[model samples]
Target: MIGDSGAKSLSEGMTSMHELTHLDLSHNNIGHTGAERLSEVMRSMDGLMFLDLSLNKIGDNGAECLSEGMRSMHGLTHLDLSHINIEDSAAARLSDVMRSMDGLTHLDLSHNNIVDCGAKSLSEVMRSMHGLTHLDLSHNNIGDSGAKSLREGMRSMHGLTHLDISDNKIGDSGAESLSEVMRSMDGLTHLDLSHNNIGDSGA
Candidate 1:
């Protein structure tokens, strides 16, 4: 449930990918090559719910392949890809997927190097995502503009409960942006802003 070697065995058990509901391939070395194989396997598994691929080497190319597979995964609820080293374009592709995937409730992208552009793309996704309850974007390069984008995009979102933006270089401006979001977001319960460079003026 936490590692990758065990996930490989589970992948092998997926003969037709029908009974598989959850798949956690986190901390694995499943780069582009492995993602290619995963895409093939996911084609038949339309019943997947929770998929965790955090701490892996799934870069932009691998993420793109995964997004291709995600088109068929209509049952996916939670998707974790923390520290997966995805670039802006890859995150944009994933954002496109999130735009249409209404079943996803939790999305984790912490520790990845998704920059401001990536955050912008995710903002686009947030506009269309109606079921997302938790979203993690910690340790990225999201700054004030990205924070503003998130706040603006989340205006229409009514399901978000938890928002994590820790370890980013967000300034007081970003904090104020999030405060604005908090004003409109009555559903948010847990908001993590630890390790950021926010000032007292944010409150």
Candidate 2:
């Protein structure tokens, strides 16, 4: 668990001599500078398979830097970036990274301020990433339009098994869109849509 202070040392580009397989830097207040520093070292760890930077203050700029770093990281299998302020542009950059990440199995982008455009960008990436099994988009402000875009993209993703879109403002239209995805995605075993505004009308 790399905390805020631990993140600062990483900002100095201290590369581990040994092959690091996993790095968890969640719940840190390290902003863009620290994230940029982390991105610089990502290229050195060729054996890294998992990276968690959840609940950080890394905004769009930080996300862009990390996405740029990911262009060279082909071994990453799991990536958690929940609760970051990665907006539409950052999401777009990450989408491009996802296209090349053939080993990515789990991706979490929940609790961000992503809107419809960001959702669309991610959906485009999802269409090509067939290895991803888990996806979480809870607490984002993705409304019906975003949900629709996700559904269209998910139609081709037969490997995804778990998905969470709870606590969002998705209304009846969004629920309908998700229902379509549920129908098409037979591999999915768990789905959460609690606290959404998909009332009786959608059911």
Candidate 3:
């Protein structure tokens, strides 16, 4: 259980390793305080390209702190924050973080508390990520309105090849909207919409 204290120690030790490119601290039991410590050291990581902090307990506050650290990480290519207990309250702030990550190609936000408003805020930032090719938003609470907003935001993701929005509150209307968007996504090769409420009319 590498908790908050462990994270602090790790951050302290890695302060001189600015050239590091990949970091995976998944399922480490780190919380808000740990995230803050990690944020402090992240400012020096200009070469970082991959980061996975999935399955932790970094809720809204933790997410905000991490976002602060990510402001300068423009070279980041992949970020995974799945099942981190992020809620809608952190979506807008996280969107700001994504602005600096415009070069990102893979993003995973599945199994969180992002509802329509959160998804809307996140999706808007995604519009600027023209290089994005993989996105996962499964097991959330997004509905039709959120789906429509995401569709609008994803209109420019011509290079996108994989998308997942399964196990949400999407009904027929949302499914239809996503289908329309995916139809135009030229490079799209994979889509996951299972466990939703899509009916035959939407399919």
Best by TM-score: 3
Question: Candidate 3 at 151: error in angstroms?
Answer: 0.6
**What's the lDDT for candidate 1?**
0.82
Expressed as tens digits, the lDDT of each residue in 47-117 for candidate 2 is 77888889899999999988876777788899999988888899899998878788888999998988899
**Model 3 spans > 4 angstroms off:** none
Window of ten residues with lowest summed lDDT in model 1 = 1-10
Provide the clash count, candidate 2.
Answer: 0
Clashes of each: 0, 0, 0
- Which stretches of candidate 2 lie above 4 Å from their native place? 1-8, 11-13, 16-18
**Which runs in model 1 stand beyond 4 Å of their true positions?**
1-15
Kindly list the per-residue Cα lDDT of model 3 for residues 126-202, writing each as its tens digit. 88999999999999899888998898889889999999999998989988888787888878889899998888998
